[model samples]
Target: MSHPQAKTHRMSEFTESIGTVTFSGIPNEGFLALGMRNYWDGYFAGRAAPLGLAPAEVVHAVFYNFADGEVARHIPWVWGKTTPEEAIAVRERGSAAALRQMIGDLADSSGLARAADLATRAAVSAPIEGRALYAGLRALAVPEEPVARLWHAATLLREHRGDGHNIALAAHGIGGTEAHVLCALAHGMRPEEFGRIHHLPKPQLAAVIDGLRDRGLVNAAGGFTDTGRATRERIETLTDELAAPAYDVLSVAELDELIAGLEPICAAVDAAGD
Candidate 1:
């Protein structure tokens, strides 16, 4: 038997898995076709488009975890390369294409349609206050196509939960770099490796790790101490609690249907290695 809160607990994992695949996978081809030359270029441009050529400071504030000035290097520059409407258009198209390619015949299933509907409801119903990314995405029209609709819904819920996570991180007094270190330690990743993924410089990463160690959040082996592990768990648990409202819009039965409906689609995407 499953834990009573298993469905609720898995909401973030499920939404993030599908949403990131849609965000970073085959759709990247569309970004490249749009003339973006690198991952950071497309990432800053595509995700930040909804904020309408936002300045680096604003993007940095909302994104919350990027290395200092990392967002500044791309934001308005990407806006010059592609309009928000155009970026959003290709995002939907690319996601639709990726989903179709990954799922093949399952693209047209009625279950997907129902899942889309349930997911859409959850996304739309999530509170907008303080959720900049989620609010911006929710403003756009939901896609008419089922696959695109599911992807969009996933993206919306993903952003919704991400915004909540930022809030949780902030309340716990964790800074961006420190948060990355804690996350790495918690996940058994080397803090340097995780920081490098976000383009943090070696000096900055070393400084962050040192600070964490001073606080006893990290040990000599670059792993979390008991307090560090507990802190990360607290932040994650709080994030899940904050994310609860979105899923609350659905009943237990509806939530199960949506999860069951998307599980195979997620599996297919995983199998395709995209």
Candidate 2:
């Protein structure tokens, strides 16, 4: 089925776009690690501030904030740069004090107070289940499989351009096999259209499509199923909720200006082929 051409102002799309640009030029593994790190940092900071915790407390929270399995999955990135012992030492020694200092510094920065206030408001307005839903998606996308990476890549592309077509194009440009490209399109277009777009052989793409269909995530026509739609909507809701508090902190025009300022950088990164 064809979706309307209506415009959405979801924060997830924008954040993902920002994240995509922020990480695009880096190695894929590095980009994934950085994305997870930044996400956790922001997430913990927001969650802790409402509890009246000191900044150091929030930073220290990271050690136990995520499950051990999740930490194990991401620890390789940290370990790659530092010995495991060193990594443990750094976290043990610096997590609290550094996080506290960072928070304090942010509080002292001009306009940062407003941003924090906005973020708090957004969090309060958001659904309690939103975090869990997002966590599931994050886990799915950040896994070791190539399919996982492609999904992550597609998400980044969608955020960057706010268009699935752009995602398909960007995925193809990034050396995604045809199957990967098709999976990206399946989220936003019909199967036949996906087939027409790329001539590359992709036997696995068919299986992926079938799996999504069986799970009711996509329809036979390749449009999002109800579950898929709901997932996307939840993402938008969480982002907007988070960003709303900040909205009052910046004039509408200023936000536009910020995006405008970042556009050139995004363009350069996009042009640099993955």
Best by TM-score: 1
Prediction 1 global C-alpha lDDT: 0.82
lDDT per residue (tens digit) for residues 38-99 in model 1: 87787877788778777999999999988788888888887777899999888888878887
- Ten contiguous residues with the weakest lDDT in model 1: 1-10
User: In candidate 1, how many Å is residue 104 off?
Assistant: 1.6
Candidate-wise lDDT, in order: 0.82, 0.35
Per-residue lDDT of 1-274 in model 2, one digit per residue for the tens?
1111221243334334333432222222232343435443333322222223333432233332232243343333433333433332222223222222323433244343333233223223322232322222223213222222222333322322222322333333321232333355546665445543343234545655676667676677777777756644554344343334323444455545434433443343334423
TM-score of each candidate structure, all chains considered together: 0.94, 0.33
TM-score of 2: 0.33
Give the winner by lDDT: 1
Worst 10 residues of 2 by lDDT: 1-10
Q: Tell me the lDDT of candidate 2.
A: 0.35
